[model samples]
Target: MTWRLFRFFLFQLAGASLGRFLFRGSSPTQGAILGLLAASALWVLIDLRRGARLLLWLKRGETAVPARVDGLWGEVADRTWRLIRAREQKAADSEARLQEFLAAIQASPNGVILLDKNNRIEWCNETAAVHFGFDPKKDVMQHVGNLLRDPHFAGYLAGDDFLHEIVIIGPRSTASRPVRLAVHLHRYGEGRKLLLSRDVTALEQAETMRRDFVANVSHEIRTPLTVLTGFVETLQTLPLDDEERARYLALMARQAERMQTLVNDLLTLSRLEGSPPPGSSEWVSVRALLTLCEQEGRALSVLLTDGSGKKHDLRVEDAADEEIAGSQAELLSAMSNLLNNAVRYTPAGGRIEVRWQTLPDGRAEFSVKDSGPGIAPGHIPRLTERFYRVDSSRSRETGGTGLGLAIVKHVTQRHGAELRIESQPGQGSRFSIVFPAGRVRPLQPV
Candidate 1:
């Protein structure tokens, strides 16, 4: 400031000295005063020129300071440049953070969408796009309600009630393949909204399975209990001959055994779900498993025929002398279940073949091919579901617990194996468990 003032006064002094000499005819004081005013005006013009340069630099948004500009304007330009750089850096950082947040949302399993104040599509992640079949590029700024087109969701949005979520069928949903989404909306900035969605088809199916399981269990237990109750009441209320009493007792025992089998199957399924997977440290012999399964299958066949000698043409072929690496008890139970199911389902004199074969690809497969009435295409997929029956009456008549295939599936998964079912109506059914090469090994060094 002192230097600026000194320069101003020096200009005025130079102007006064020049005026005193040049205008000697006039009074020196008057001449000097006139020169001072002129110098001051010239200084103001130069200052304005520098200020104009700074304004131009700012208008151009240049980072570099204007050349040849000095004094207060220079400092102003430099400080302004620094401030601009800082602001630019802060904006860039915010953009990066926004991108990172969007990336995280994209990777999320659930769907997310950002809606504008007018409920238009502002932004959405890939999951949301997939959930709603949205084309992000084309859908931007489009009205969300128009795209959704669900009357329930439109009403939900209109109602101004965001306390709960709603489920809607996805665009790709079909009768054969179902897609259910759980969606919720929350109010955000300035009348904007955040829509979140999750694929709840699996959860819905699980809940359904749970309800069906409870109902089936009650019905299964009730049927046997009813028969047992009737038998007990008859024994208590009437006097009967020894043969009649013996027959009634035998029938009662059969019903009790059926209930016991159902309970055991349920317990097996629970244990498979609760326990850790069976390890490969314990080896079970394939031949031994086949032998046990054969014995049980034939015995079950005989029982089904009521000792009438119209047994199935059952064959248990151990073509490969392989060892399956897993719990022996579980392997035995699984193998026995498959074989017994074939025997029970196949009619008397039908052909039932069990074989342990090694696939061409170093994998071992245990298969049961039954020449019974084969299952329909629709029923094959859900055969492993608990209590799922193609023919409930026939399943009951065969004394099936309806949990055999479910147990098989669990056991196969635990052993790192795949349970495959191939069947067509009247062409017979083939159920196979393919063991991975890691789980199937031949006897080592005799």
Candidate 2:
């Protein structure tokens, strides 16, 4: 400030000298007045030039700090530069945060979409793009309704009701591998909206399975219970001969046994689902398992033949002396189920071969091959489903509760084994459980 004052006074002095020289014959008072006027005009002009430079620098939006100027103009330029730098840094931080937030949304399993006031898509996560079958780049600014043509979703968007979520088949859904989505919209930010979608196909299928399981169990138990009740009533109300009584008692016992088998299978399945997977610490001998299966299989085959002198060509070939790791009871149950299924399904006098062999890959395979009527291709995939049967009547005649394959499947999965089924209609069926090398090892000497 002092320097500015000094320079201003010096300019005035110079202007007075010049005025004196120019007006040498004029009066001193008039010359001094003109000199002061000249100095004031020169000061104004210098200030204007600095202001013009400051204005030009601002217009250019240059990041470089302005050079020092005199008086209030220097202070004004410095303050302006500081404000601009702060604003730029704030804008950069905001951009970085926005990118971080978008990245988090992209990694989410569920779909998220941002829509403008006009219902056009502003942004969407990768999951949303996949769910809606959209190109993330190309689909921006496109109307949501125009891209998703589902009538249900269109109606949902049009309606004012947003309290409840609507289920819709996603754009990528197909008949075989259907994709179900639960979608809802939340109004936000002045008429704009957030669209949230989650894949619910697995949940829907599980619910359907639960319903079917309950219905099937009720039917299975009720049928046998009804028969047993009828038999009991007959024995109590009517005077029956000894032979009739014995036959009725026998039939009732069979029904009771059938129900017991069904209950036991249901328990096994529950336990398999609830318990941790079987580990490799406990091992069961393959030879022992086959021995038990052979005894049960022969008995079941004899019972199915009903003493008509019909017998199966039952063969047990144990080429692998490996020990399978798991619960002994579970292993036995799984192997027995496969063997029993073979005996039940194979016609009398058909060939049935049970083999335990070690593959070249060090995996041990327990296989049951039967020359009975092979399952159709369509039925093979669903054979392991609970209570699913190719011929329900035939299965009943064979005294099967229809839970054998399901139990086998659960046991194999628990033991880290793969259940492979090969069958062609009218040819034969081969059911194999291949145990991983980690679970199978050469038998240790006792």
Candidate 3:
């Protein structure tokens, strides 16, 4: 400020000297007045020129450092530059944080979508694009209702009530391979919305299976109980001869046995589901398992034939002297189930081959091949499901509880083995449980 004041006075003095020299005859007061006016105009013009330079810099966007100036204008330029740099840095930080937030949403398993007040899509994560079958770039600014034309979703968006989520079939859902989504909308800033979606196909299928399981159990138990009740009523009310009484008693006992078998199978399934997986600490010999299977298979065949002359051509081949590490009882149960299934399903005098052999990959397989009617391709995938049967009436007649394959599947999974089923119409079926090399060891000489 002092420098500015000094410069102004210096200019005034110079102007006054020049005025006096130019007008030597003029009065002193006139010369002084003329010098003051000239100095004042020149000072005003200098300030104006500085102001104009600052305005031009601002107009050019002020991207670079401000130019050097003097006096008040210089101070103004410095302060303005600092304020602009601070604002730019703040804007950059805000943009970086926004990108990070979007990246986090992109990594989420569930779908997320942002919408404008008009229900147009502002942005969506990759999962949301997949769930809605949308191209993220092309779908922006498109109305949500227009893209998702499902009646349920359209109605959900149109309604004011957004308190509950709705379930809808995804756009890519098919009848054979279904995709279900649970979607909900939330009202956010100034009437805008956020949409969230999650896949619920597995949950839906589990619920359906639960319902079917309960119903099947009820039906299975009721049929046996009904037969036993009728037999009991007949024996009590009728005056039957000794032969008839004994026959009725035999039939009642069979029905009672059937119920007991069904109950036992149900218990086995419950245990398999609830218990921890089998460990590799206890090793059971393949030879021992086959021996047990052979004994049980023969006895079951006899029972099925009811002591008739007809018998199965059952063969047991144990070519591998390997020890499998697992619970002895579970391994035996699984192997026995496969063998028993073959015996029960195959007709009398048909070939049934049970083999325990080492695969070329250092793994061991326990396979059962039977000359019974082969299962259709459609039923093969669901064969391990609880209570699933290819022929329900035939399974019942053979006194099967319909939980054999399910138990086998659980046991193989627990033992880190794979169950493979190969069959075709009229070509018979082969069921094999392939154990990994880690679990199979060569038998030691005793």
Candidate 4:
């Protein structure tokens, strides 16, 4: 720039000398006047050049501009370039930091999504895509409401309230497997919003189990305690005969047994929770498990007389080729529970059938079918839940702790097996534990 200014001044000086030599005739005053005009013109040219350089830099991109110029113009141009470079460097650094932060968030387990002012998806992490059943690339710029059309979520976005989140059940969730998501949205930066999602099915189920467990424990204890209280009051206050006293004592004993059974079930559940999955070292035979069930059914039948005072027939179907790899005690407990349930529910002279068979795919199934009043379709799904009962009065009469199916379910899970229930209201129920191929073994007949 300085060079440019100097060049301009030199051109002005040459013009001034030429004019003085041609028209001034050695007049010093005239020479000085022309020189001043030339100098003013030079300054104007320099100013113009500086303005042009600034415009050129803007048009040509920052890197195209030269680092230095001649004279005073060079000083101004260099200062301007430094200022522009500083601003750009700061911007680049800020952008890099922002990108790093976003990358970190993208890798998080919890889902993260950003929405524009129009509520369209601007950016979303891979986790968010999986949670929402979305293709990240495809779903960008799509409206959040359009993509997630759950009524609760729609209402959440539409209403003024912004405090709570919504739980959305995935389309793929089923009885065998469940997928649950909790989604929340928060507004920021004018009208833009941030959405987060988490897989909360396990947590939700745990909370529900805790509540049900408390309720079940209270109900179970209260029933026995109420009976004990009544019997104690009867013995203490009423002047009863010797037979009456014996009858009341027997009733108290039965209640005590019921409470004891409930406590045992609770302990079994705790053990299942704390213990690791069963190892393959313990091989339990199918015949042995069925035989145990048969014995238990017979014993329970003696004590259990139906409304008509007749005993039910307990039959164990022999499958010679099937054995299971699991703890004998756990296998016995599971088989016993199913058999007991069948016996307790079946009416007088009703037949209870226990069958074991191997599937074509190498899986083994132990099925208990009874000729009794079957469960409703709705109750079938929740039969494995601890303390769930179809008929509380009947369950109590049968001396059931209501944890039979729950125990069976946990045992099956530990053995990596599946529990399937098929029932009709009047056709009786079929409860089966479908063992995985790994746990099932073939028995060699002698």
Candidate 5:
């Protein structure tokens, strides 16, 4: 402004001096035209200066002036600020929701893992850590293949057939009660994947047990039914002597008895499993229980005895006359089964020892150890299973129902007792039932 004003003033002064010197008789019209020209130039200079200042202020991060009147620039600025604030608020909300989702997944029981396009682990929940024996923090970004080296899992990942899921045994399956894992993988979002794992160990075991139980029951029933059918057919189709007929009838009767016993045992197991737990009830004397068992054992001995008196040897060892609070009938049955099994399996001249003793810890152990052909180590664990027999031929010959041990097991469990089986092939087996101290009762004075 100042420089332009000074230039104009200097020009006007020069013009006036020249007009006076060159045209002393000039008219006032020329003076008026010069003054108008100077004023127009000054206005142009002032406008130019204003524009330069506005540009400089804008470059220096100052607010720009309104391009138009009627508050248009103000409206633009307000809308831009509001848009930025709304976008920032939306981003914060999204982050919060993502955190909540992650927390929910972390609390889930099933294992969950997220994989990137390269098949590397991007994220995993804590349950996944427990399932796969992995460190959730350190294993991030590691290839799934490197951490899980199981051949089956490796194949699953590499295989193109991913429409279906697979079930495999997880880590610590053998020792830690056998955990079964159902793994499912899904493709998502441009080559990314999600892997979900669930523990189905209990479900799988229950299914297997149900199938086995059904199959076993069928097989057990069919064996006797087959014999009965054969005998009936013979009786109907052929004329037989009285002695042969009697023998056949006896065979049929034995088979029928065997089938009945198996059915009774199955029913007993079902009842035990479904019934309420045993309560503190009538007190039964262990001595009396043993006395009853001895009577039954002797009867069985007589049945199997040969004329030489060398077929069965039964020995009864009386420990303290301890009493236990439980169902007397169940206890008697448990004791009688053990004694009978011992007598039946022990060879001629082989002794069977039955003991009812009180341990120092106040627990009572009713043990029936026999010199019979001992069970193998593998068979001992499953000896209590229904219809499980070490020697099917011998079991039939001895009138063994193959459910005696199973009954004992159920009875002991109902009474809070422990059944310990010690056996080795060719060394004879020892079957003992240990009743905890809590179940033991003080004996009444005779």
Candidate 6:
């Protein structure tokens, strides 16, 4: 400011000096005054020109400092340019962060969506698109209620209460392959909302299975317990001869044995589920496994025939010189279950064949094929479910605990094997377990 003031005064003095030199012969005072006025006008004109140039730079959207715009105008240009650059950098950082947030949401297993003030979808992740059967690109600005159309969800959104989540059938759900989703919404930004969804089909199915298991176990145990109670009462209240007493005792013992078998099967299933997968360390001879299966099948056949003189035509095919890796007890248990099931279900004089063969790919297959009252196609898939039965009364009459195939399934899985079941209404069933190559090997020479 001092320099500008000094410069202004200096220009006036220089103008006065020039005027005096040129007009010394005329009025020197008037000439000096006139020179000062002329100098001030020129200075003002130059200042206005610099201000105009800075204004032009701004109007052109240029960020660079304007050239020849010194004094106050120059400082203004530099500061304005720096502020513009800083804002641009800030905007770039915000955009990058937004993209990263969207990418994270897209990768999430759960779905996420953003809605505007009017409940229209502003943005949604890919998972959200799948959950709602929406095309993210085309669904923008579409109303949330219009897309979902679930009455529960519509009411939840319409109401002010968003404190809880709701479960709804997914848009792509079907009768057999049902899909379920848990959804919740949160109020954010002013009148806007954030929606979250997760697939809960597996969880719901597990819960359903748990309920069914509890009910089945209670009913199974109650039937035998009721019979035992009734027999105990009769024995305590009635006067019977030795023969009648002995017969009643035998019947009581049979019910007790049935209860005991059911308990043992339940325990086996629990152990299989709790225990880790069997390792491929201990080896059992394939011949030994086949012998054990044959023994179990024949014993069951005899028991089921009960001196009827019409025994099952049971056959055990010769086994190859191979060894199976893992727990021998578990392997025999699984093999026994399949063979016993075949024997118990096959009618008198029906054919039952057990085979153990190594495939060309080095995997070993242990199969039990029975000419029983063949299972229906629908029941074949769920035959391994605990306590599942095609004919509950028939199973009880045959002394089956209804957990045989479930045990087989668990053991097969633990040993890294696959269980396959094939059956039609009239055709007999074939249950097979194919052990992985890693668990099957050629028997070593003695």
Q: Give the winner by TM-score.
A: 1
Look at candidate 2 and tell me the lDDT of residue 438. 92
Answer with 3 or 4, whichever has the higher lDDT.
3
**Per-residue lDDT tens digits of candidate 5, residues 1-446?**
57656866776666555545544467655665565566556655765665555445446643333322112233454454466567768988999999999999999988999999999999999888888988888999999989887889889999877899899889767863788899999999999999999899988988988898889889889989999999999999999999999999999998999898888877877877788767876788888888889999988888777664675667788756568888887888888998889888888778888988888998889998888888888777788887789898898788887888888999999999999999887788788999999888778786
TM-score of each: 0.91, 0.90, 0.86, 0.70, 0.72, 0.87
Task: Rate residue 321 of model 6 by lDDT.
Answer: 87
Compare candidates 5 and 6 on lDDT and give the better one. 6
lDDT (C-alpha, whole model) for all candidates: 0.89, 0.91, 0.91, 0.85, 0.82, 0.90
Off by more than 4 A, model 1: 11-42, 64-68
lDDT of 3 by residue, 203-243 (tens): 99999999999999999999989999999999989999999
**Candidate RMSDs in order:** 2.7, 2.8, 3.4, 6.5, 10.4, 3.3
Error of 1 at 278 (Å): 2.4
Write down the TM-score for model 1: 0.91
Q: Write the per-residue lDDT of candidate 4 for residues 1-446, one digit (tens) a residue.
A: 57665777777777676656655667856875676686677777877787677667657776545544555656777787878888889999999999999899988999999999999999999998888788889889999888887887888888877788888876457877898988888989999999999999899889988998999899899989998999999999999999999999999999999999999999998898799998997777788778878888899888787356677877787777567899998889998999899988988789888888888998888899999999899888788888889998999998998898889989989999898899999999898998888887776454
Q: Which ten residues in a row have the lowest lDDT in candidate 6?
A: 63-72
lDDT of 6 by residue, 217-327 (tens): 999999999999999999999999999999999989989999999999999889889988887778889999889879888988888998788989998989988998998
Q: Against the hidden true structure, what lDDT does model 6 obtain? A: 0.90
379, model 1: CA deviation in Å? 1.8
lDDT of 1: 0.89
Estimate, for each residue in 321-428, the C-alpha lDDT of model 2 and write its tens digit.
778889998899999999999998898999999999888998888999999999999898899998999999998878888888999999998888999999998999
Q: For candidate 3, what is the total of clashing residue pairs?
A: 0
lDDT for 33 (candidate 1)? 77
